[model samples]
Target: MSDERTETVGRSGRLTMRDIARLANVSMPTVSRVLNDSPLVTVETRTRVLEVAQAHGYAVNRNAKKLRQARTGTVAVMLDFASHRHGAIGDPFIFELLAGVSEALSIRNQELLLSPPGLDDTRAFEDFHRARGADGFIILGQGTRDAMLRSLARRGIPMVVWGAVSKDAGYCAVGSDNLLGGRLAGEYFRMRGRRRWLFLGDIRHAELRLRYEGLCQEAAEDKEVTVEYLPIASMAFNATGQTVSAYLAGGAQPDALFAFSDTAAMAAIGAFRERGLIAPDDYSLVGYNNIPPAANFSPALTTIDQKTDVAGALLVEKLMQHIDGGRARSILLPTQMVVRET
Candidate 1:
């Protein structure tokens, strides 16, 4: 470590591995090894090289490194924008899931590329993979694209979905036990002596279907209980609100209601209030996906907890397993009821 080497860096006004090597009195290869955190480098040499590089503010070009390694070192996170009336970006649950995945990727020193919506088809997935856009993908929702996802899996595409798990699904998935979540809500309503029940949310999607089925199953246990449902295509606030408002205007009276999502439940609540109806007193309501706003809602929502905190780690782990030529199995997390004002 001589002053001459420091002067050389000042003269060039740019830092490089070669400069770091010279300053550390080591070969360029040694500097590269140390910078890459290769275990082959001795502790003393690694420390000296790192100190020199840190002192000069030298940083490795990750893009060049990834290119040389022939791997993008990035994961593309895709969401089904069309499924939601306001797009997936408008959903708070989507943001929560993204934050989890982003944190998990950061821990592994990998980049997260948020893919735009409408990349739901297999060919689009293939093209993106072939173009070296990312090493793999993490889909946010299955949304009736199970067939397309199966095709991608058959073609050896590396992907993992965050949604309901299907028995015949070819790809890996990480999701909650939606059926149990619905049953819990149903049981709670029954205990509260709510006989007339109404369910909201489109069952065309596999996850929502399971929840509806579970609620129905629980309701069937009591002959006096009657369950009805309204098919809602979009989870957008305005769309759900309008749909619920119209249903209420039609004189649809139900003592209990269960929504597939907290957002939908909130929208329904707004609709009910517009018609001079309220929860608990008028109807015992339950919602799914205990999102952040659920607890702080005017009458704090009673919803299901889907364990989103560890979902990202599991999704990233499973996707990496697929990328590494390993077969990763789908995981179904346990769901629980979070009782609140609603």
Candidate 2:
């Protein structure tokens, strides 16, 4: 082939994979397979081809890449109302989770399509199964009464959820051990001689409800330790702060507080300050998710770490299994405590 036809340089003066293969003393198809990250290519051959490509500054052509890949290669990410209703979708925790998912997809040569907020769940799901837009769907958090999920499962849709796992839900899910997390928080409080424990966060959602149940169960054996549940009307900082303020104003004194998220826990701390109270002194507080900002709070937060990185990777791995016509089982990652001032 002519030099211009087979080895045109990109804006960065790029070398084509053909040129790379020639320089690395390998077949052109071998170079192509390595560039596409095909596991069929031997490790030593892939390393050599990649090293040569890197040394020569070879870059894949975008247009050619588009034509090479079959259909739209993407996974649809849908944030259900259970997570978006309180605006928790934009929280630091969610951002971390999404970053993990994005990284996992990048490594697998796929893209992520985030469904528009407030999207009709049925329509988005239909697009995944019928319209052939995304290879599969990943629901960030399942809303209460997931009837739509059941219907789609009956139709044999390939989807995964990042929330509570229940046989009744009838969907493959990947989530942390919320029951263990809540029990840990409650047990710690009881061990510290806390009498009144307050549970914060909405229990209507399956995950929060599981955490609530776990906390209540932990305190069940202790007659002296009383556990109370209060729904977070909204996840907004101000809303959570106001809710805590109202509870304090109503003469409810909690010796320990187990919040559903770091966002809620931090907001409650601010509310406590406004009410002339401090954590671990006046009361002990535990938060979930261990988001980045959890450690920066004034009293720092004691929280349950869900290991977002691992969670994200597992979610993608399970989704890929379903997409490839394999059965994807539910996964429950372990939780650990990050003890800070609170």
Candidate 3:
């Protein structure tokens, strides 16, 4: 009987759970349970079934499973195109954060759907969710869409944001302590006795605003310490570089500088270099998001680490909780300083 069943399975074009069950010498229900990751199946039986399925190169029909469960088992990850702009998607830190989110979702057997740019409006977000496109959403940055996100949350949407957490935010968020990061940068500048500090980033961004506020708070302690902020509308490398270059052209020199992103900081460095200025010699510099290139840069940037991997895991976990009909609060990850040459 075993030989006959094996021969029949071999003749079939595609192997099914029934074939897997017969090969593993288990009941059809047992194979089904194992495939569904149900705890009802014994470990030894589950192992045998999986091995048989793998041996036959079987693939599960995810669409059918989603229909049965009435859940998409996919998460939509939205980027703030309005703030970062199109080219800014190439930013390494965004890739790192996305990688973290993808890794976390894979462990949970969830799919990641990268939402199209310009979905910052509440209507688009609602349309996507209502159409069963994703089980939930994980927004990469708050950008200037905080109000839109809040509206979605009030409508009982399952979503989590990666940004600075506000006390009255309706939606759950997971992010580093921006205020603390900025303060650390401020303290570092003060410790070196560097006055005339400059900040380069768009304060319209919630996260960057918090960073600027923290730096200002620390600089206010000493009247001699002055902090000036230049709001760059776009975070693109060329745009940021041009902005910094123009500022330097105006003879607005600062002894120290802090940028909200590593990319912006590197751009500022290049801009200053054009004006015969160098980091740690002409001015001390600090940047946020300790991306890989930060260490490889000419000056080896001093930066605040946002713990991207942990933040990713937390974002997925919190979104899952929200999907399961549970309340998940915002999480603020501790920020750490990575002091290098800059």
For this target, which candidate reaches the highest TM-score against the unseen true structure? 1
Order of candidate numbers by TM-score, starting with the best? 1, 3, 2
lDDT (Cα, tens digit) per residue for candidate 2, span 1-342: 654324554555667765777777899889888887788899999988888777666677855675566645778887654544455555687778788888998998888888655446566567645655677888787766467777777777788888888877777988988999989998888877898999998888889989999999999979888888888766666778899999998988888999988988988988888888888999999999998888988889999999897988888999999888898999888788888998
What's the ranking of the predictions by lDDT, best on top? 3, 1, 2
Q: Which ranges of candidate 2 are over 4 A from the true structure?
A: 1-71, 81-88
Q: On a 0 to 100 scale, what is the lDDT of residue 311 in model 2?
A: 80
Residues 68-111, candidate 1: write the lDDT tens digits. 87678899998877687656447698889999999999999899
Q: Tell me which of candidates 2 and 3 scores higher on TM-score.
A: 3
C-alpha RMSD (angstroms) for model 3: 3.3
Candidate 3 global TM-score: 0.87
Measured over all alpha carbons after superposition, the RMSD of each candidate to the real structure, in angstroms, is: 2.9, 5.5, 3.3
How high is the CA lDDT of each candidate model?
Answer: 0.89, 0.81, 0.89
Off by over 4 Å in 1: 1-3, 6-23, 50-59, 86-88, 116-118
